[model samples]
Target chain A: MNTKIENKLTPVRIIAFIFVALWLVIAMFPFIWTLWGSFKVQADFFSKADWSNAIFGFHTEKQTGGFFTMDGYYGSWIEEEFWRAVINTSIVVFFTVLISLTFGTLGGYALARSTYRYAFWILMAGLIFRAMPHMTLISGYLQPFFAWNVWGILPTTIIVLVAINQPFTLWMLHSFFLNIPKDLDESAMCDGCNRFQAFRYVIIPIMWPGVITTGLFSFLLAYNDFTVTSMLLSDENETMIPAIASFLGTVQEEGKVMYAVAAVVSATAPLFFFVLFFQRQIVSGLTAGAVKG
Target chain B: MKHSTFLLFSLPSLSVMFLFIAIPIVSVFIQSLHIEHKQVIIVTENCDPFGCETTTAVDTEASAKLKEKAPLGKFNGFKTYSNRMHFAFDEVGEAWKSSDSFTVFTKKLYNYPLYRALSFTLTYTFVVTPFVLFLGFLVAVGVNNLPKMFKGPTIFASLLPMIVTPLVGSLILFWMVDGDGVIGATLQKIFNDNSLSLKASPVLTWIMLMVYGIWHLMPFSFIVFYAGLQTVPQETIEAATIDGASKFQRIRHVVIPHLMPLAIFITLILLMDNFRVFEPIIGFRAEAHATSISWLIWNHLRESAYPLYNAAGATSMVTIFGVAILLLPVLIRTWRDFKEKNKG
Candidate 1:
């Protein structure tokens, strides 16, 4: 690794470049595949498609340009339920992040500044809670929700997402709180500001990146999840991932896989939106929480 | 006064944790001891003998059904375990069905289809998680010293995958991977017919999964790692340089300790997530072959035809046990640090 950099123009340097270049090529395959698969019609897709079914049978019966047609592929996201999933994910992401930021700030400050006896247990518990699979809550636990009511939507999904995201929120925020130099807290105290005032005015601004990244994670987790949502949400109207799979599953066996493939491609938009927006802050925030105090 | 206020701040989070996180864990243990709403171990003391003699016919029928299959009555501790073991051992030659679609063990959990679903799922997660982390870390380290003008956007691009909601991301990958999808048609136009079937290939499906997984998770590790990199004091690096420390030396001596906590955090996060991971597996199910342990468990809950719902429950607990052991150290360390930090 170091051989390439030592001379700057050595064979090793060229090899290193080639290796990285190759890595990029390998990494680009799936995205390329998704794009390629979007154009092929159903029959061509079914006959020739092997494993990566995203493009194989992507054609339709209409002979607009022979084997090509976007309608056969990209038409599903226009469906009402797809939009409902968007709204459903948005609702959970917005509120769950909101809850994490609000509570995480307070809890983090408390952990950083206060003498609490059970703080260790709380932290450990939070770690375990975060570590535990969200699916367990839906499948193994929460019998009442499955058995008793079997109806309704908002509170159930919202509450569960909120709980699932809390552990990561608490763990990450606590680190952010620890990073603030104690002198800052002392200086605020000396300036006649109480702890809350110090936290609200002095600390919160500095910790904005932490709050943002944690909130981003919470939002992403809620939006991307499938297992708990599959069990907790029986309603097709509220389904988030019911449509994204392509070229495989029993759906493939039933001949709908091609259509499903088209539908799933549209799901990539929101995540792109997040990456496009939070690029810098996410990096700074996560590295800060991970690498530093 | 200062410490107490902090406690006040922590209260809502703590309470919420107890209510949602803590309580659910307790319920898992409770459910494990005795199956819910059945007669695995009939609680005669609760109602029948106590004089609150109200019982429904449906409840009676259910209890009767439970009792008939339960060769191990209330006095029989874990008799079902032996029975299952016996069944598995006896059927070694013919473990699966006549159609040979799936095994008795696999079918017992959710129907054969769920495990069928899981085969693809496990295939994807096993392939996706490690490679994403490995490649992500390399990218983070490589771009660590670049100028912000180049570095910021470079790292930002990696974040592209993580930022997208999984639902949306999977859809995009789904379209992008198939040969007839947008990119494939263009490739075919440029290179002709030989290039189009990439999405149909199972190997290509995993490649797509790895790409999507990397795209989604790279941002997370990059951000986390970049943050950690920022904290590595210039003084330490300067000191290493003055002593003629090689880049490897700096990375090994100065950089690694500097990044240990972050690395551990991300790795642990991945481990916990890997076990319970069901989304990408389920999401990519159509084309990309995959399923995780959690998905199989879920299949049992959602799919009624699953032969052994109880066995799936038991199998899922196997995954939980793995998580509990792997994360015990992190949980312990966090507890100690949290206590120290909370001391006013």
Candidate 2:
């Protein structure tokens, strides 16, 4: 009771609350501003005599007809055909996650169950893979991809992303499998199920939580990746990240900064809702790596 | 499980890893030792006119056929790695011999693409890693002490920065720091300087990036540490309190030691991530003032007409070596942990 009382009014507690409140503001403020600013003209947001012109929609007459405008969204999505990039992003992300998870689960399960010395070495290799910057491997891909005429295609990029994500996906899922009791699978095998049968019929249902958590990470990687996509993809196959990046390069000269801003907001909106919906899974997935390590 | 089953299960991942990760690394190293084929030019002189003249021309047709025959380019045997854009060995030596002072020599060193990137990458990695850890730890403690009702929303808010796409997040911050944007204008107004721009200068850009690094990564550290905090023994805390230790003393002695492993885990991840820092630089369009190794590779690859694959390959090798060196401590720790676990 005395400790509980002390916790209520201690200077440390008060200071912590104040600091966290400030941090919360700093963390959430930029996205909110960007979201609102995306609905306005460049002049209103970035060229007015005062910054409040952004909030009040002052001097935005040419870009918008009213207090709120969808011109940026219209310009980005329709005029510039950002929808193609969106479709490309969605397709790549879907395939990358599917392929990565398929391989990651099998590999992770094998690594977790096997006692072979080779498995240890393989896991070590995965660690090295994790540490390697993707750009290094991309350099190798450029030549072979060009030679094979597979460069700048979605399938090639998807496969490469899956390979790149495998090390991390394997590591995370491996740890997740380790937490599951080995006996669960062993008993299934005792019941005359083969290893594959045991994995399919017995262990899989229980593994969904871990799989879903790992899947969230894979999705994030496939979705949020800019470096891999930008380098591997071409103009026809631009993903949203690279497409928006191209906007940043071209929009300034063309006076369409608002399109880039709108696209940024559009790209971020999914992630915003993603966090809101999947916060628990994300937190578990995130902490799972550190805790296991 | 049968050995065959294990092998079959792991084969797909193993194959992909080999095809992409392992083999590409080997290929990148090999590719770094080569350069594009250049046509041999012939010089001819004509003395039929009032004055003699000379003409030099590249034999393009022969060069094109040669390129098709050997598309990997001619092997230069590490010459590409030492060229001006890479290690710049010759230039560095000249600068060292000719420069009057250490500062001048250092300036000349930074003029080389490799060292310029190396300096900034190292500084960003070292500086951002510690600050992320510190801020994350602070936020974790703060949120841990908060009431349950506030914790969920606070965490949700904090996670936004980390969860959003890196390029998009950096762009959001970029807009805010634009010269006429809200935060930038407000800053100027407060400082009484209309011309001051955070995006215009190098030092300020680095600071903003560092701030972004902290903000973006803090939630990760906070989440991990908060989880670590929950598992800290309540009995130890009670014991410390009953022994009349002050709050700071108790925290320093008990809480920190308890969270040390998580701290180290966060540090390892941060170091690796920060070393490959590319997206923010791109999103910020900061190539003028700050360029990372990854950015250098991007620049080389983006040359549409004459993509410098050789230069990129060399830079990739250097970046890989840098990552290896930075990861040495963590690798040692991992090995030690594995040995101890095996022994136990």
Candidate 3:
């Protein structure tokens, strides 16, 4: 891909390399540092005497008779029951992704195929709905949910998350469906299949690539969400993010800041692997709107 | 597709959006017009040895019954919208009358909860959007110049800041900038000021939050711009070079105009996201110095004694209005584009 004008070691090339290298350090260093420090005692991680102690683990060694310790992990996972939150997160994320995709695929397909004005209006309305903050909607749901006796449960949260997720899900999947040929579905209908039958027999199989890409985003939204889950779910049903936040409150006062550190690192691990595996899908999904628009 | 077919296909998704999103906004408006039920007070008269005395006390059971009967509380019209915690019309009027200058008056106005949150939210939205665009463009250019072998790893690392949960990302930064943490400690040592702490200063806290915002948002913009760069057309670049144009001139005249549409898309998303900047404030514990509209609603709902549904509803309605105003320009632009496309 390189041409003669772009290949030379010019001043601009050097600057670009240096700038990217600096940004990489800024982006990745915090996670690496936190991951490393999670194993150390609070005294060492927040070393009063020397910053070098954090890297060397002097205080950790003195406290636990080793260079590394699992005290933070133990305290958060076992003593504090962070595993309950982990299980709760798994349930919420799984159901939210499943339901959002189910609803989004149907709606996105119809919007993509229809040439009607109302279809355009629906898409526009979805765009506006997408921009509403989660907290505002939660404020509305509180009184109603409380009155209905459906508040503070996993099912209610999953449904709300699925609804919040619908707008973006529809938009992304709509663009993806638009990229598919209309002839594929039309031909199936021509063969005496009904609309649903065509979508089931013809469109469903080929739609997996788009569905998978859209599902990755749906999964991320459900997993990374803090606002809806935090406010809607009861304390017993708290997910990982809110669990970590609550850790900050009680752990800090009890001089167990390392528990919060370990929890943060634990929460970040899945996302790290998420980017590693689904990097391509995430990139494509992010650019889908831009490219189409 | 026929109208019947479309309706059958889209009903489930549309129904949920209508029920949860559309209805809730209307509900938020309705709730904002009402305030919570006041406690039921009863007076008891007793004759003591010395004198007759009367005492007033709140009847908890009656209050509970009242709340249960009407969960929406008493209708108070638009009073909640103008209260001190919201638009604060009375407070603003007082400040306007007392102060001789605009800056002085604004300083007085900033003391109100709504104004303080609004100023920070607007400042953050305006400041962070542009910086994310500019820096994201630079990073995209830089990454584009890298060797093919290094691109994937560089992109992966860049995605980390953006991909992680916002609260977790901010907390990681918050810990580092704590008084005893590495960055914070090193700064103190370098400045020879042991008392220096990032969390203690309002200005530094705002800057820190903005830096966190940029860090968390820039990667999305970078990825979009990088994709746009891939389609910049090699023929055009070669033509610009052959025509004796410098790299900067070619980029200014050709490449930038190519990416303009993507820039608009990123800016719209960034503004919407930044306007709801709630998690970072909570993560960084920066509420003492700064707040946002979303955070104001959250604070009201998370009140110590009981959830102030009315107060939260009022703030939420204001926030919805803010979002509507912010999206109006883009909505108008999109409508115009749709019309022109149809005509052509």
Best of the candidates, TM-score: 3
**Better model by lDDT, 1 or 2?**
2
| lDDT score, candidate 1 | 0.60
State the displacement of the C-alpha of residue A228, model 1, in Å, after optimal TM-score superposition.
2.2
| lDDT to native, each model | 0.60, 0.89, 0.93
lDDT of 1 by residue, A122-237 (tens): 77677778777776655444465655575346567767777777777887888777777888977988999988788778887788766777787777777776655656664553
lDDT of 1 by residue, B224-296 (tens): 7666677789998999999999877888999888777777778766666555656654555532344456666
Clashes of 2: 0
Which candidate ranks first by lDDT, i.e. highest? 3
Query: Which tens-of-lDDT digit does each residue in B214-252 have in candidate 2?
Result: 888888998999889999999999999999989888789
Better of 1 and 2 by TM-score: 2
Clashes of 3: 0
lDDT of 3 by residue, B1-344 (tens): 99999999999999999999999999998998888888999999999899999999999999999988887889999999999988889888988999999999999988999999999999999999999999999999988886676689888998899989999999999999999899999999999999998889999999999999999999999999999999998999999999999988988988999999999999999989999999999999999999999999999999657888778998998898999999999999999999999999
lDDT of 2 at B313: 91
- lDDT minimum window of 10 residues, candidate 1 chain A: A50-59
